[model samples]
Target chain A: MFGNIDRHTYITLSCVILEPNSPKISLARAGHMPFLVKQHGGVSVVTPRGLGIGLASAKIFDANLEEFSLELSVGDSCFLFTDGLSELQNPQSQDFGYEPMLDVLRSPASLSAQSIISEVMKSADSHAQGHPQHDDMTALAFIFKGTNKILSEYDSIPL
Target chain B: MNDVKFTIDHQSFGDVKLLKLQGYLDAHTAPHLESALGDLIQDGNHKIVVNFKELDYISSAGLGVFMVYIEDVRMTGGDIKLSEMKPKVFTVFDLLGFPMLFEIVEHDQIALSKFTA
Candidate 1:
């Protein structure tokens, strides 16, 4: 369905599905960076095999689309980002880079996943030195705080 | 501006020569290094050590420059070895799966020493 859309086309959509008995948080990527999983006081870069969203003809699975399970207990969070976050550069042409991103993740004030995303975006924006984005930037963060209310409030805080 | 800062100098470690780099290695400055290394390769100076004592960063594209010349240098019975990468840069190299591919060391003098040993 995505391949049919032209490159110049722009659309936004969102959906929610509640699967009560689904196995622990599962994510599968095709041609996408392995999303960042934050737990145990460490940031792990998750890289998956395959092409990005547009390459439908390319196989997303061999035998079956296996969802990589990440065990997320309460207080755990994950950040999914595109190339834009790391590619941003400052006036000096220095990349915002991964180290800074790690720093933001480790900051005490950045407790919630949404706060982490906001901090990451702000860091990228500031480091870009008022330069415009070179490409589309998108991030999705999921934080497990043991309940839905806490997660929703944390996710909705505007940047 | 390109972050890499280096002045051309020649040093002899036994029979090998070393060129030291002192800045970041990313898309912006990799071309300069590529050209320098290209010239050395053309001149048949295959035994080389790139001292990265001050290098703080590298991107995947920067890594490509070395990968492109690895086979050529080896075919000539010469090799390119890297040494003295700052921890930040080393982490990037490690993240990109380079430790398994390149000869990396922790000291500039020691890295140059590999060309002789």
Candidate 2:
């Protein structure tokens, strides 16, 4: 059905399905940027194989599409983003690049997904140096707190 | 206003069509590359090669152009092979996991040989 549409219209997308309290994650990619998975004291990029929508027929899409399953351990974090974040440029016309983004992920301060997102956005803004973003910047982070300790701590917070 | 210009030069090698892209490939310039691929597919020329040696940058929009036509070309018993990419340009494609979905060769001749093979 996608192939029948005009070629000029195309989009990249990524989807992740997770059930509450489940460690198994199902990830689907559609020509989107590779996501990062930080766990076990290391960061790895998950580049799942898939094609973009409206790019081909259902037959081709189904043949090439692959779903990835990941079992997250306690304290594992996953980061998803668009090209806009990595391609952000500074006054010197240099892109923010993946190294810095990875650095942020590797930081010890990245105790939670929210913290990681905040640090990355702050870094991007600083790198931009007042240059307006050329592309839409978006990112999503998921931190797996498998144990009840973290959940109970959240319950202790004042409402 | 950024003065970023993208150009695509088409060259034919037997059944293979080569598109040499230069300059940045963002949302603003993705349509140019998309149209080029569309024309090639329309002409019944499915075997294609895109040279990224001179391409300075490629955004998701630019990458989407490849996804747009790869399956159609493959269905027609043809393929869009990439070649001669600079490391910078290649990194973007690599980051997006294109190397898994597309045939990316180090040299143009290698890509050409694959078409003939």
Candidate 3:
């Protein structure tokens, strides 16, 4: 029932759909920042161009929208965040930026997702030099450990 | 520093409604924005351009307001456009991937013209 509205007033979002016990993840983008995946001592940014939800007609949005699948192995991790983390400014008014964040992601493979997230947040806070936060900082780190063999074994037991 | 406060100014360019925002847009101020946008939707004025030149900051909560309303406006054959965001303010939206969902222009005039196009 909606008519043609202006496109400027839309918001951007990124969503990841994961199947239980499956390594494959389906990601949909709506003008959000790229998520990063770390594997084999290398980090790759997943940035698929897509229009925002309200910026175009349904047909146009569908035509431009992209969905991609990723298979993660054990010890692989993905980092998702809003700009507040990378854009945090210091006393010199310099932003923390993306490079340092990539460096933070270079943590040892043995580190858990929680540990990596802590390190990332700590680094961002230190970079701020005690300046009061100007924007909200949010992030999610997903570390794949493959299928839970122990749980599977338990499931196989007669109950 | 001044305690964070937000204010909205309503203006019109023919059928397009413009809301100029000043100050920070965080959880506290997000409700005000939602109320303002809601009022516009109620009045059937869907063409909107939110000028953020005077806005100093935006949090995720502020961003959520746009997400909540965009679809409703679109369903009614109208749209909301954003314009004149400061680099910092824009970064917040960008960090959350808003550029993909919204048509962000550098100027109010540009956003205004999109309605005609």
TM-score for each predicted model, relative to the true structure: 0.60, 0.77, 0.60
Q: Which digits, one per residue and each the tens of the lDDT, describe model 1 over residues A18-45?
A: 1334325666654344467666677776
- Whole-model lDDT values for every prediction: 0.62, 0.80, 0.76
Which of 2 and 3 is ahead in lDDT?
A: 2
lDDT of 2 at B69: 73
As a whole number from 0 to 100, the lDDT of residue A131 in candidate 3 is 78
The DockQ of each candidate is: 0.03, 0.38, 0.15
lDDT of 1 by residue, B1-117 (tens): 553253334576765768777666666777778888888888888888887776665665466677657667889898888887877676555543455457898776776666666
RMSD to native, candidate 1: 8.7
Position A48, candidate 2: lDDT: 76
lDDT of 2 at A157: 31
Model 1, chain B: what is the TM-score? 0.84
**Ranking, lDDT, top scorer first:** 2, 3, 1
Candidates 1 and 2, the one with greater TM-score? 2
List model 2 lDDT by residue over A65-156, tens digit each: 88988887888778888888988899898988777778888899987776788799999999999998888899888777884322313333
